[model samples]
Target chain A: MMPVGNLVGMVVRNTVRSPRHFALSAFGIVIGIASFVFFLGLSMGVRNVILGKIFPLEVVEVVAPRASFMGKDITKKLDDGTVEMIRARPEVKEATPRMKVAFPAAGFGMFEGQEIKFEVGGFCDGVDPKVLADDPKLAALFKDWEAAGADDPAKTVACVPPVVDDKGVAGKNPCPDPEFYYCDVQDNRCHRRVPVIVSPTLLELYNGQVASTHGLPVIGDLEQFVVERGGLARMRFTIALGETMVAGSAMATSDKKRRVEGMLIGITPKAMPIGMTVPIEYTRRWNQEFAGDEAASTYSSIVVTLNDKDRLAVFSAWLQEQDLRLEDQLGERFATAIFIVTTLFVLISFTIVTISSINIAHNFFMQVSERRREIGVLRAVGATRTDVKLIILGEAALIGVIGGLLGVGIAFAGAALVDWASATYLPRFPFKPPTYFDFKGWIIAGGLGFSTVFCVVGGYLPARKAAKLPPAQALAAQ
Target chain B: MSEAVIKLRDVKKSYGSGAARTPVLRGVSFEVARGELIALVGQSGSGKSTLLNIIGGLDTADAGDVEVLGHDIRKIGEKELAGLRNSSIGFVFQAFNLLDHLTCLGNVTLPASFTPGAKDVEARGLEALRRVGLVELAQRHPSELSGGQKQRVAIARALFGAPKLLLCDEPTGSLDSETGREVIEFFRELNEKDQMTLVIVTHERRVSSVARRIIAIRDGQLVDGEELALGAPGDAGGAGAGGPA
Candidate 1:
């Protein structure tokens, strides 16, 4: 066999003998690899948006089992007693009970006078407003959700890291009042924002699927178009309480309705199929006057938050053992779809690459046949069979690496083109991705590396055939 | 005292299998002492090339024991045989099978690439090219060289590492008469001046006349001086002078 120092030169020299054939052989592999990288980048970008922007991993919803009763399915109330029992576990960092507010559709808007009706009658859920202050872990987890950089202007798209005081504690309660955004303390008169948690997915759904159909304005970049607007579009809310309302009545009079002006202070992800959530204390206070029988401080379900996901299994098992079920609210079906799509994309890419490999092998076989005399001469000049094999396989590997790098470059340029076209001409495209592709270093390397290996693997048999050609017969022929 | 560079005893070789099996070398026995210039003369398909290949360690003998440069043929591995070929035997072919892409220097240094940790390959290759009087054509690719120049490069390649035995398979078959004569004279001079042992396989009288001993092969068997009527046609004065080198 040839020495290590000369192997690369020999391979390159042989490959350069017929550049057109080398290019033709590598073209198929390049296409396969480029599409592979493009699809990988798309999937990774989608994952960032779905998981990073929408799902809150630190929170999980727990509900009591309906099997406790024999009648039609009823939500077994999660009273204060149940909340304490579940919170007793060491893994439970914070447990906040939730309640549903019963308000007229006209009452759900920003401020008292400006009536902005929701197409689906926006959800007004309730929870303890002091949950963030009581649980430092939950506050720290959602520090960025409720507050922005203190120095940032109210208009720009900027989100800074959570500031830490000198004592090393993260600054979470940026607002002067923990339970309110804007208020007046004198005369026991205080007007506060209805602190609500609405998912970014809801805004996306409204803009993409629901809003334009219903003749509503499409919301793009909620922080810019909505939150920074500081008007009916964002920082306001209104609630009304009927003084003489009856339960489940067809015509209940609301002549003594109490309208309250509110502001939007905090935003949380409703990761599940739930809607807007507010403080439960506010809901119970309103429900007490509206319906005496429905004013009890019991909840059908509660959300328990943990500091880390490693402790979730133990906590979840403990809950299930106690007839409580858990829901990640991050979507099981969404995760499965991502997994299936990713797998199919990879399999298809490999199938194309494998076909290309076969093409490479068959192409080199032709070259080997053409160079039989050359092989014989090399054998006569002290090159062993192994050396010939190494030379051929080395050429194939070089072609593979070249094709892989070309594929990655093609993918990047292709992604840039897509992003530009979408932004320029298809701005109204329902699911306008923030970016066309996400380029990860390791993934690119892996794609290139795998392609190179497969090329070598594909070259194995043909290289062996080249090596095993009998030198004397080959020399005799020419 | 002169030592035997190549020794073969009862060496046999055949091609194909069963009904198509054709014998090439049948019980061949011979020895060429170190520094002896010999010509293996035979017609086409006379198995002369096969015998030379076996001696060069490029092919294996099927039936008998053979030794080249003190390495037993049947005892060692293929890599060891390759190493033996790399170090002790150099082959020069008729077609001048220099890779078209490599320069003359690159072609000459080809053998050094196979030996592990070979140093000064360029210097040695230039020296060999200089010996062949083609030192000025060292940087020229084979395609850029003339027929005589190509043959000289091939010869320089064979002589690059200075092996113990140089084997030429009709080295001048593709060259014109003048170039062929030049290559033959080059071989004679190397044999006489450098003490380089040589085995030239040819049917040309010009090639065989310069050899010290002309061995004839017919249908896989070595014939005597009287039975060389068909193979050695122009061996009038050169044939019967068979004695010690």
Candidate 2:
């Protein structure tokens, strides 16, 4: 064989001479390759975001009182009595009863005609400490809480984190109504005051405002959180009560702040677990006299943290066996939907790439036919069928590479746009957005490889035609 | 010591099938000696082109012996035939058939690119172009050249490989009478100076004069082959009985 360099030069010259045709043929292939890459990236990214990073790792099973869109008809409420029943079960490692106060939801403590809206504080019984040690993700946060106060470590006290809003905790806890504090006060309301662990999306909502107001440095201050449902709402004596508790915090980080209301709610890692509390006796005493909502007195939900995350399904199934209903709500369902969408995106992209490859093949076929005489002349002189095939296939591979790069660029831009959009909308809706960029490499590289193969396949028809052209007739075509 | 470059005995060819299977070449017998310049001339539908194609290894004969350079074309497969065509012979067509994409130099270098150990094909290509007085136009593409220039490029391409025989199929049909005459003179020079075997299939009176031997075909059979004198001979132009079947 002659030097590959010479052959390459000839191919380049031939392709360049008819630049219009060459460009047209490769255009479809390039676009196809790009689409494949983009789709793959997005799918992989979605998978990573949804599954790779989520909080409240230990508190796997949550018993909520509220009926979701796909409501499960539960026969009874999981109050203090139900928590005791769950504790008696063999599969249940540690069952803690938590409650959500409705009187606070109706209205918070008002001072000097300035009424403060009370956040639905999640209250839980003190954890056995062994449960925290069993789960790694929970152990870190438990250690952080323990470090906050080692002396009388509020082991069974209710801890509320301050709402780190856009203006950073807005005010100091020096006054009685700290929630309505002004922006100028440099206080510990954001960090030490409340131990607020928000969603990554919601974090932007506060925009480090809580950090500055809390008089604490923002670095290493943030925490991971998860929220699980508070068990059933029950009406007792003319009061419709819904009491949910945020678990996983021993005591509020600061001494001045008794309780703080986080703006966002629902079952997420950012929301506290259903187990951590100031002790059930203290919760009954706080709600019975301080607030008139009678139903808030009982344990509305029993939060069960198992020995292993994999055992969650077994525990949940056991709960069902005991006639206790387990329902996954709209938010968790929405995460599952993300996976489906990513799968569809991949399929659609592959289809587009396939079509583009076909288009490239058609273009090459026509080109070979048009250049039959040239092919024959080459053959007559000394070009082998292999040489002709190489030129065609080489062109296709080039198209795939160029297209793949372009597609990756497009995918990056798309991911950025999605991130921007989520940042803008997540806090307002009070739901955390999953992280991005997890599956990028697989999508981009795999897409490129797939697209290149498609392009090469497209080149097959034209290559065969070029090889099959009779030197006699092809030469005689002139 | 007079080895035959091409040998054919009772070679036959047909097209289609059943009643439609029209036999093109029937029982043709011939031999082309090494370094022999012989012109095979015939009218339209004389099957001269078919015979030429068989000899060039571009088409296969149905029956009988057909050999070129010690390889039997009838028995050998398409691959060997193609190899034979590429290494042993060169062709010049009526239309000049130059690739539009390649320059005159690129065109001439194409054939030798196929042959093994033909590494310095480009230099030989340039030499061939120089011989045709188109060395300066080597970079110019075929479309950039005139009809006469294109044909000259084709001639250069044929000579670049240094094949045993240069096959011409009405090589001057597309050019004017003057350019055609000039092309014939170049063939004469090639035959006389380099002893290049030049087979020109033509109907032109002046074209045949360049060749020492002229063979005429009527239908598929060879009817006449005679030595031509330097000056005008008796009925040399239409002396053969070969015409349209």
Candidate 3:
């Protein structure tokens, strides 16, 4: 057999002489390889989008029910004690009672003449700024938010009321803290006035309803609004204190159009008991509301903070032992669904790529058949059958390479287009699928290489037949 | 007398089998010694080409002991047979069989390329073309050459590897009388100077007279072998001289 290099050189010389035919065969391989590359990148991009939105790696969200009550509404109250239980777990690095709220809660916010019916679905659950500092992930998110200036000074903690006590010392909550978002009648201190945080989305919607004469609101300043209490209307507005909301506006219940409003107050970590289940007020309220056995009492879920994040499952099992659910945001399910669908799409794209590669192989086989006379001459002149085969295969591989490169080029263009569109229209997560021309380009190149080489393999039998033709008969052939 | 370079003993060859079988050679025997030139004279269907093919190892005889350059033709596989043809036997076809795509030198060097250890093959091919006095035309394609020149290139290709036997199916069949004479002269010179063994299959009496011996075949059977002295010294030729090797 001639050296593989010599065979390759001959193939190159011959195929290069007939550029048009080689280009066509190579184009087929390019399509197959590109499909492979772009599809995989697309799959990864979609996966990133789903996971980025759903299972953001750094977030540690804690959850519990919103309210507590006596009588028939006793079941509605959250068992704040679960928070303390989670905090006591060894994995608990830092814990906070993220207070949530619902509409129909009494508040004294009103307008002139008619009491403003303010349905305040408190979007921003109250959180201490210290929690953001303590959790590196939250700190990073805040830094990004601050860099973007997504909110004003008022929206940031810079201007909010300092968390303090009744004696005028900072770091206190005047009203009793609900274990979750609500309080029982017996946890009487909650009856005192307290503030609620609102999300920017809620603010945007609320701004649409309010007239411009009121001026676009800033985060820290108090905004006047009205509410209804026990069928009677009242005119009131708390000190407009702005706070940032992390996620959605709120979950809508019935279309009852209930009105509730309140001030948003900040609290320090010291204001709540250390490792106490259901901040003191939440426990007191739960006791008053359910009046049930302590062990049987519980909330919907608890957010356990682990000292070592790797132990979340261990703590989760512990929570499960106490008969509680672990609640994740709605995004988790959405991400899972997206991942499944995207994977299927990738598989489908790969199938198309495989079929296209086969087509390329067929085309190369035809190419080899067309060149039988030339091949015969080469073989006659001492070119071994193996040499001819290599030459043919080498041509196939070259075509694959060209085709693969073309596909990767296409993917790069597509990636640029997508990124441009995302930057223009949907800049929420700043997500653009990874560009194909980078690390992922090798994948495409490999695909091209494999397919082209595979195409050569496809034409192997034909090349052999061409090579084995008796030179005498070959010369005599038409 | 020189040792026979090619020998066939009662070679019987037929194509197909059973009802479809047709014999191309019927009990033919011949021996070609070194430095001899012989003509196989016959009509188109008289098996001259088949006889040439068998000698060249391009075809097999059903029953025969055929040898070329000390290798049993029947015992070798197709690949080995091809190797035998490459290294030991050279063919000059009626059509000139010069590859149209190659230059004259390329055509000449083609057979050498298949030869093992054919180093400096380009130089060797050039030298062969020079020997044929067509070295100046080396770069030109076969189409650019006249019929005589094309035949000369074919002859140069045959001479490239210095084969033990040169088989010419019809060296002058496609040429004019003058060109045919020139080709015959070239063959006569090659045989006398190089001591080359030559086998010419032809229907032309003019082509046959140039050979020291002639074998006639009619309808796939050997008809006669005769010596045509033509004033050559110490010559006793034909199938009588081509007795058992």
- TM-scores, chain B, all models: 0.91, 0.87, 0.91
Interface RMSD values for the candidates, listed in order? 1.5, 2.7, 3.5
Instruction: Please give, for residues B1-245, the per-residue lDDT of candidate 1 as tens digits.
Output: 25877777888999999999999988878777787788988999999999988888777788887888888877888788778777778899998989888899999998887888888889999999998899998889999988999999999999887888899999999999999999999998888788888989999989987887777888888865222222223445444333321
Global lDDT of each candidate = 0.73, 0.61, 0.58
Better of 1 and 2 by TM-score: 1
Per-residue lDDT of candidate 2, residues B56-83 (tens digit) = 7766688888878899877776556656
Answer with 2 or 3, whichever has the higher DockQ. 2
lDDT for B211 in candidate 3 is 83
Residue-level lDDT tens digits of model 1 in A220-288: 554465444653325555455552123464324645455543444434453224466555666666566
Misplaced by over 4 Å in model 1 are A51-60, A65-74, A79-97, A102-114, A117-122, A127-187, A191-194, A205-234, A241-260, A266-274, A279-297, A304-322, A326-330, A429-431, B225-245
> Residue by residue across A1-478, what tens digits does model 3's lDDT show?
5545545555665667677776666665556555666666766666555444324422355543344556444333345565666677777776655443222222333444333333222322333344546545323322212123433232222222335468534333223332112211222222222333233333333444443445533222222232122111121233212211223433233233322123332222222211111122333232333233542343333334457645656765775576444566444565557668656755665665566556656776676566665564554444556666667667766666566678778766776776677667762322233332232555665666666665666566666666666554555555
Give the DockQ (2 decimals) of all models: 0.64, 0.33, 0.21
Instruction: Give one digit per residue, the lDDT tens place, for model 2 in A1-478.
Output: 4347666677667666776875776666566655556555655565444443343233444565354455755435566677777777666677766554423212143222233332344423322233335446534333223233543223333324335578443222343333322111223332212122233433433335543554533222232221111211000001112322233333323132223222221112423332122223334544664454454545555667556555556777677776665445333454457757867776777777778778888888888888887777776666666766777776766666666666666666777777787777765321244544544556667867886788788888888888777667777663
* Model 1 C-alpha lDDT versus the unseen true structure: 0.73
Whichever of 1 and 3 has more TM-score, that candidate is 1
